[model samples]
Target: MKYLVMVQGTQADYEGMRGKPSPGSPAWSEAELAAMYAYMGAISNDLSETGELVDAQGLAEPARTRLVTAGEDGKPVITDGPYSETKELMAGYWVLECESLERVTEIAARVTRCPGPEGITDYPVVIRPILDGAGDI
Candidate 1:
């Protein structure tokens, strides 16, 4: 079965992420950045070895996002976006093909242990199984 692990955070968290110094900035330091990358890489490697990892990627900042909607007249309307008023915004995600929901949960648990930005750990990753078209709507 295929699962998608969605990473979500609050609007406050997302806003706070904007214009914050890059990890490599003199105030931030490269060593800290390197460590985070190393930890993520290790997890990726381990997943690959276990043959469960399908794909994963970090996303660009949310401010660059564009929102599209259908107008009353049914024309497309475009606007700048973080897209929604909700507190939660999806940060990134991973697609995994695993043997069972239990296995997917296990992988999510492991990923939750990985380091996050600013040395403050974050484990808001959410795992859900992909639904096929054959299932009831």
Candidate 2:
């Protein structure tokens, strides 16, 4: 089965883990930040070695995003960032071709341990099965 591992986090989550300290808080050392990235890379590398990794990439922050919708006359309407009512963002994703959902879930669980800030940092990875093209005309 092919699965999409959606890595969820915000820009704040990225910065906090990468050594940007909040007011009066200590910063993460360069080594710590490097280790975090290294861990993520290692996971990808392992999956690739096993021929399970189809694709993986990190996304630009929401500030660099744009929203497009249809206007009243059906023309394209564009809006700048800070999309309303959204709390979590998809920081990155990994596409893996694996044997089973249980295996994909295991991979996602390991991703949750990929190092983060001091407390309550939301770094969630969800595993979803890809649809196979069957019963099509």
Candidate 3:
């Protein structure tokens, strides 16, 4: 089965990662950021080597994001936003083909171990099965 494992964060978290402290979030040190990168890299590398990794990506800052919805006249309405200081957004994701939910659960466990600055709490990493019978996934 294929699974999407995701990590979420807020704009404040993103700012802190980029060295701009916002409200409750503190700026991350270079070493702390490097450690996070290395930890996530090791997980991705292992998944790739084991033929379990399908795809992975870290999304851009929420400030650059756009929202789209259907207008009353049936046209597309696009606008900036849906990001806030406290609202959580997806920061990164990994698509993995695993033999069982147990295997994917183990992988998600590693994500929770990613190192970061003090006062930074570990956000929950979600895993959901993908419905991909159409071969488009």
Candidate 4:
């Protein structure tokens, strides 16, 4: 089955990391940055080696995001970020073709070990099975 792993973060968590400088800055210690990169690299490499990684990517900053709404005339309107009222926002995702949901769960568990820049950790990964046959039409 194909699964999509959604990476989500709370508003407080998102804002906490916002406007931060680049990873290599003096404000970000080398050890911290290395841990983050190493964790991500390891997951990517493992998935690639196993041929389970369909797609994966980190998203750009939320500030660059925009929202579109439809007017009464069915036209679209553009707006800024923070589109939803939920505390958690999706940061990125990975689509994986795994044998079962258990396997996807295992992968999410492994990703949770990755360390953030400030030694903060968020189990932001969510796994859901894809329903390809939902629309028979």
Where's the lowest-lDDT run of ten residues in candidate 2? 17-26
Model 1 poorest ten-residue lDDT run: 19-28
For each candidate in turn, the TM-score is: 0.75, 0.85, 0.91, 0.77
* Highest lDDT against the true fold, candidate: 3
Compose the digit string of candidate 1's lDDT tens values, residues 36-82.
56877787788788887889887665667778899999999998856
lDDT string for model 2 (1-137, tens) is 89899987655555565566664323667776787789999999999999999999988877677889999999999988766567677888999999988899899999988874466354568887888877531
Instruction: Give residue 127's error in model 2 in angstroms.
Output: 1.0
- Tens digits of per-residue lDDT for model 3 on 5-107? 9999887788899899866677999999999899999999999999999999998877878989999999999988654543778889999999999999999
Clashing pairs in 3: none
Which of 3 and 4 is ahead in TM-score? 3
**In model 1, what is the error at residue 90, expressed in angstroms?**
2.0
TM-score of 1: 0.75
In model 4, residue pairs whose N, Cα or C atoms come closer than 3 Å (at least 3 residues apart or on different chains), thus clashing, are none
Compared with the true structure, all predictions reach lDDT values of 0.67, 0.79, 0.89, 0.72
Error of 1 at 31 (Å): 2.5
Best by TM-score: 3
Least accurate 10 contiguous residues by lDDT in model 3:
79-88
User: What TM value does model 2 have?
Assistant: 0.85
Tens digit of per-residue lDDT, candidate 4, span 41-100: 789889989999999877654656788989899999888875466555677778899998
Candidate 4 ranges beyond 4 A from true positions: 10-30, 83-86, 117-121, 135-137
